[model samples]
Target: MTDQVMAAIDGSQFSTAVCDAAAWASLALAAPLTFLHVVDNHPQTAEADLSGNIGLGSREHLLEELASLDEKRARLAQEQGRLMLEAAKSRAIENGVAEPGIRQRNGELVETLAELEDDIRLLVIGKRGEAAHKASEHLGSNLERVVRSLHRPILVVPEAFETPRQVLIAFDGSKTTRKGVEMVAKSPLFRGISCHVVMVGAEVADMRSQLDWALMTLNDAGFEAHGEIRAGEVEESLRSYQQEHAIDLLVMGAYGHSRIRHLLVGSTTTGMLRKATVPVLLLR
Candidate 1:
């Protein structure tokens, strides 16, 4: 809805990748970039009421000490957030972002994203955060919430940065992928890249026709358009297509119809993300 790319920064191994992806999205969309760092809210400890309840006892002294420690921890967190933002801004600038905006807020990340949703054209984030930095089998804690909470497109960087050469869009002819088609057709985001639009189960009554219409739409928008109709499992089919075509970026609708079909969790999107070696551009 807005003309800015929002990049969420957590001081994890994936931070640099996120910044690079944000820079890429900003350039592609020809929009400003904003790097956001969230200093998560910490709940109240047993210190505030100590002065009253433990009336001049040793317990009060210990509680007051704990309170001071909590204050120090909060200060350290603020400083760390500032440093992370500075580093992310530097990365973005180095990756061709002209001038990037910085926003450090104190709250939950999802709530912060919800507040800024209306001003975001694209959201860039890491696939995992520090809490899930296993690099083996962990996914970001807030990935699903952020995807479901925000309506704008999200560019998720899994590994290090790679400039996208060819884009593969996994289409199902659903409203979501139709929206993706409209986005590619009307927006500057996929402007100069070749697009391969593929639909699984094209033997269905209207699937082939739908793919044709999508191809026509992309052709009209000046894309080097290619379409494929494959009959196989959705996630595996898409992965094979991307690999066969040597695609660098994977674009698709965020999920299917029901919450049960979410991509971020134990759904088809999960399998795709697990097997995908490239970055994902997810649209809802």
Candidate 2:
């Protein structure tokens, strides 16, 4: 089967960043990119029922007005979606990416993204929704649900990131880390790029040997990767490393421990997302 990269675009400025990231990956993998825009079904007004207190004729008029507004909103959303897709396609062509396919699906974001996972090598999404609060660093509810449910790797791009140069891979010998490493090793998108494989945790007896094994795996796959072993909390070490290395992208496994453990101890993935200044590639 042909591999594809699926990018979720909602016509926001952040959606443009998502498209750019997806375009880069598409070129790297020599794969097709599919742009998907989901039309959310949630009603715009929760107070529509309150309008019923008026006279029957007025209420009927209000209902008609709401219906007309909804239609106009849907049409505008589709037009914006088309414009964004066209701009992305033009950029891709300029960057030597093949013609990309675009589609507008009418459904919730999470379900649509999950349903498209079978053929997608990577899913690119914005870090926040269009109307998210400025202070929140977390993904919007729709993106979060997709991240938790989809089985593929997700690349979350913030609003201001332009291009990715240096990449940091958060390593700890877990299955998730291994999977992330494999992706980097096999994908052409990371080829000839400077990559740092970081292992963070308290000092262990076989840390050197573990690092050696990880390095060997990358070397065997023809990736020029350097290893670093740090003694501290995972999140703290990651932040320090990013600043020191000027990392543009952070690649790691999503929440290595069990849900119960994560609830009690918190997760490094969530911590990094909230604190780090770069984009994150999280493998599930």
Candidate 3:
């Protein structure tokens, strides 16, 4: 079966943008769009232990009431998820996705997406979820986890939607990043978009050669491609270039560095996702 463009929607400010961005991706890939809403059941999973209480009768009554309340809360949460999915489907339809599908699952977001990964061609999610709606400086707690757990490409969108005109690829000469460049070259998602491949490091001959290869590959694939080198921190240099060129979409490899290395310093992927005002497409 052809994989679908799956979008993770929730009751957050980013819902509209997520829908819009998913619609764009769905059209770009010529794939069906599916909106997935996960109802986290962690809060209501554990039943209270009312044993060893002074009054058995009172304990039983209290347990019954607690169980009832838990049932009610779970029902309410499911209903809310259903409503959110329906609304997202409507918005996606309005945004030019014909007959978008909606799914409501009861599980953790990362686990649910992993379960559905085989059916997803591209995964679109918000930069911040409902829990982090007001935390502008922080990325959604689930974002990194989802990226780490899933093998599929993920598109992390900001809270606002804007049709991407230019795309920036942060190249690091890693295997993952080279694959990302090739994907961009071949995928219809970035067709006809201006592409920039940049390396942030010392201006060495090898760095220049790598940038030239990226440019050549993109140009051969029929993209209006550009290449450059910057000297500074990876995240800051990329951000500055993106702003200067009005880049609406950013692409890079997801956690290409080793886990130990990142633990010692930090993950460039996390930093970019946290700071990028535009949508970021992370290829793993």
Residues 101-121 of candidate 2: C-alpha lDDT, one tens digit per residue: 887888788888777778888
Ranking by TM-score: 3, 2, 1
The number of the candidate with the highest TM-score is 3
Q: Which stretches of candidate 3 lie above 4 Å from their native place?
A: 44-54, 261-266
Report lDDT (CA) for all predictions. 0.83, 0.78, 0.88
Which candidate would rank higher by lDDT, 2 or 3? 3
Q: What are the per-residue Cα lDDT tens digits for candidate 3 across 18-64?
A: 99999999999999999999998765546666677558887788878
Q: Top lDDT: which candidate number?
A: 3
Number of clashes recorded per candidate = 0, 0, 0
Model 1 pairs whose backbones collide: none
lDDT of 3: 0.88
